[model samples]
Target: MVRGKTQIKRIENSTSRQVTFSKRRKGLLKKAFELSVLCDAEVALIVFSPSGKLFEFSSSSATSTTERYRKCIKNLRPSKQMDDSQHFEEEVAILRKKIELLEETKRKFLGDGLDSSSIDELEQIEHQLEKSLRIIRSRKILLFCERINQLKEEGKILRKKNAELREKYEERQLELSIGQQFSSLEQVKEVETQLFIGLPNR
Candidate 1:
């Protein structure tokens, strides 16, 4: 009896799987041979069993056929530029992942999380953090210096106002003292004149 049509997925039963493998392998080889013979064309087929047994078929000497295959592969190889572009894309992806990981580790080191990480990766992240810290410290120092300079300018203005007030106070004090002296002298003169004018004995 003919077997039912089988699906292309892996067969679960061990015996059935092996039997299917053998049947398909033979059928494929048979078709390849028929095609080669009908077309009068060179053909080569290689099959390997799941158990590591090798099988080979070639219309010509295996060596010559293999050489021809190698030549064809050489002629059809992808261009160097294409290979370089593909490699560049892979490297860029790797670098982007590294940057993302470093950023995540930076957050962890700054008390963000307790993610599992390697010591080496942590060290790299630490170095990156150190660099960022230095930059932040430098900026902070610059801002502080600017603030200090502004305060100094303000202090200079306050000092100038203080000196001006002191000078104005000194001038006011001198004017008050001179006016009191003149008034006291005038009073003394007036009393002497009155005493002389009213004196019985001089």
Candidate 2:
């Protein structure tokens, strides 16, 4: 059967907890000693039990090792801070130079700082301006063509509407003419009925 993984929490039973602590403490000290020997390095470890008992290990004298550690940390802090400060200053200087160059280029483009410019530089600026003008003219022509096509479509729609209106008007005029002719025939019939010859009944 596969063993279950142990949960990492405080052991409830005092006896078990004590046994585990003792075993782990011995293992930790052994590992520290091996590391120092194999790597030829300075190593130190300190542990305190719940009963206030001190347990410690050091590759050399504990006092000397701790003092050396303190000195190394103290010496490294200032130099690291100085290095960061210098790096920040260098970055700021580089950015300032870039900004200055951009501003100078803008001035040259505006024809304000050309006293020191060479003939080649002036010719390059002129060529750039001509290219820009060509782009603008091309865009304008495209807009004009699009507008003309839109107007032509509108004219076609208007002509179609005019033809429809003319057809409707002609139909209405024909209906009126037929109604007038029918009314004239009805009047003639009435006049003939009224014209009886020479007989009067009292």
Q: Give Cα distance to truth, residue 21, candidate 2, Å.
A: 60
Candidate 1, run of 10 with poorest lDDT = 191-200
**Residue 70 alpha-carbon offset, candidate 1, angstroms:** 52
Stretches off by above 4 angstroms in model 2 are: 1-88, 193-202
Error of model 2, residue 107, in angstroms: 3.1
In model 2, what lDDT does residue 160 have?
Answer: 93
Model 1 misplaced stretches (Cα beyond 4 Å): 1-116, 193-202
Model 2: which ten-residue window has the lowest total lDDT? 190-199
In the range 138-195, model 2's lDDT, one tens digit per residue, is: 9999999999999999999999999999999999999999999999999987874456
In angstroms, the error of model 2 at 87 is: 4.4
**Which tens-of-lDDT digit does each residue in 170-195 have in candidate 1?**
99999999999999998988874333
Instruction: Using TM-score, give the best candidate's number.
Output: 2
Q: List the residue pairs that clash in candidate 2.
A: none
**Top candidate when judged by lDDT against the true structure:** 2
Q: What's model 2's lDDT at 162?
A: 93
Position 33, candidate 2: lDDT? 99
Each prediction's TM-score against the native? 0.43, 0.48
